[model samples]
Target: GDPGLHHLILDVTQNGVTDHYQLLLGVRRDLPDRLLHVEIGGTSGDPGLREGPDVPEAHLYDAAHDPDLTRILLDDLAAEASVGPLRFRHTAGAGIRTDLTSLPITAEQSNTSLLFGDAYICKLFRRLSTGVNLDLEVNLALTRGDCTHVPAVLGWIELEPGRGARAGGNGEPVTLALLSDYLHTGADGWSLAIASVRDWFAHTPPAGDDEWAELDASAAGGDFAAEAERLGAATAEVHRALADAFGVTTLPAAEVHAMAARMNAELTGTCRAVPGLAPHAKALTGAFLDLAAQAGPLPVQRVHGDYHLGQVLRTESGWTLLDFEGEPARTQHERRALAHPLRDVAGMLRSFEYAARYLIAKSGTVPPEPGGRLETRAHAWAARNRAAFCRGYAAAGGADPAAHSVLIRAFEFEKAIYEVRYEAQNRPAWLPVPLTSLAHLAT
Candidate 1:
């Protein structure tokens, strides 16, 4: 019987750029005030304007995927034999788990009901791979490896029953969502970054303030370096674990150079769109080329496809990662592209720049540091973390640090160029986040 998932509650808000359908849903009370709660895209279209998330990625009863093979699945779900008053899947993580056959096939478009309880996070897959899904794969790996920081894989539902966890299901897993213990999280990477920058803006160091306190208090005395160091180490472990699972190969000089060429071309065009990013773009691209030219290319590993602080969680237990969706917009091939692990390092470094500038923009005032200090600080922090990340990375290295350093710098430049376009389109106020990198790159 379908897990009786009855009574869906929905509440949604408009997307930032357009009132268009980016319908977002999340536990309102469980989240911070500034966090933009979202439903990934239940129904994400103007309706009159276009198609969207609220509509469901794939039909509920996909013949190719769904096990019961019909809408009957929904009915069977509601009608599951009753186990007294308790919901059949009541033990399921978060939200209302209903007996499918009981009442109706209800599909919620939005709700405040979720906001009333612990957050129920749904893992939305950008690319559904063959075999055991990566979510299940990682959970299994974590369990086998005895990793504790990651969310426990309480259980997962086979949205398309026959499709998931089945030998015959091959390439058809209905990667809907998983049932893991919800993260009663203290903060996400972005939130912490915003908090850290707020402190910096207030003339306080990241380590001076208590991050767990009231926002104002944290700003008065912020201290994020410890967290930063921990995050770096955690990321290293994650990569090491991944490498243990999937072996790595050394990158070819031709392949590394090819990527550098693509990056350079991308920056050339991207910088022109926003003059502010031009100087930074040039420098960033130059650094990467310089590194590649010298290093003869390093070994390639199965690195985090889209690694970044935003992809992490910060808890007392330590920092952890969420989402293996990879670049979100890139092709599966691109996301899985093997290069210097520095690609991940560079991504995190870019995030610091993103975070620092994002808070300043939100506050509508620049940091107190004048002249090159702001850029210098951005560089210092990025350099510190990059170095810290490298220290851990070096331990796992197939190559030495001095040689990998050049390759990493190049990736950092490449990542920054992507940021320039991202900021120009989505956050003009933060266009400088990438622009800042571009500026540093230019000089």
Candidate 2:
């Protein structure tokens, strides 16, 4: 059976003139179930096949182990030829550019990342957007600023609609793929933190060793306080560089109140959506409201909206930050908005708590006393690292995140509420991770 009429109407505004165009896609019974072939402008272009229905029918380009597709795209760009409605553009740095090499391509949630034989990693964004891509823009800015905390940009692929074809208004070019330096030896921060926690949890204090029992997180064999501090310093350095690159703005009280209002709304909705959050709603709301009554204006700048252990990497030099795309679920407009730097600080703090609680929940051993002994150790580890991170941040050129305790607490509470919903929908068994953080925040 042929899949019925698929009509895609795009309103294109070019040269101050707006016009509507339609694309009709009819299924080919002979093709695979996941494939979609496009037809537009009363002429059937190449029946380019796509694997998934979720993927956009137009702009179907795949370079995974297919040297032919790579050559086609590159040749199209070189010859300025139009392959159906898709147009290709490429840019190179000052150095000589390398020819396309066949390598493995890995698909992430929102994009496809390909390794170009250790020379570069090319990320092809799954979804299309009208404006400039943040990943490319941020990497370019950071590289120009000589910020060593991020990878250098190599080149990218930009796409624009062909003659009479309309995707977004104005027929403006959109970044479809980004090429950048790949860190071969870098280990993600989350994996390192998890390993450290597992190692520390497996260790047993010697018999009758009262000193070892009383020792805190810093004295443990897998103590992460030093690394946490260094990561903190690196975070602060990146924040400083971002501020210098993109000028900072002052957030007024009205904006603060509006942010609090949004937090309250989200908490209210989450409490209704997840029955487990009902008990802590009042306390969390109190924290959110506290942000509104703050004394003065807060400093705002472009920030990594979703700062977590997974977003950073620990390389030989130090902590290197990656993925400036902010939250994957957020809109491009929302992700680009200026925010308080402490928001990122708060996010990192919440990440530490998550790592600790996750380890404790996954641990097989349980103490006989049943008085939350494992939970206590996890909390201690989190607290020590949190404090060390704050100290290092202050030692760097940034203000102490602890100084804005109310704001940080509010952000942490908000993040926990979000995690609660995420776990409820995705991993119900891990619901305890965020719930524990909510319980502590309530206190």
Model 1: per-residue Cα lDDT over 1-443, one tens digit each: 12111211122335642111111122221222222222222222335322343432211111211212222222322343232221222122323333221111123322111110243333323223433455555654664565665666543433343433322234454433344445665478877866766565566434422431222222335656656767767777777776776677877677767777888888788768867775455467667678557645456776666777767888778787765546755654576566566677778877776765565455545645544455544554554544555555555442334565667677777777777777787668776566665555456
Quantify all predictions' global Cα lDDT against the true fold. 0.52, 0.70
Model 2 weakest 10-residue run by lDDT: 34-43
> Which 10-residue window in model 1 sums to the lowest lDDT?
18-27
Q: Which parts of model 1 are misplaced by more than 4 Å?
A: 1-120, 124-140, 158-170, 204-220, 295-297, 363-403
In order of appearance, the predictions have TM-scores of: 0.64, 0.78
Residues 421-443, model 2: lDDT tens digits = 88898788888888887676688
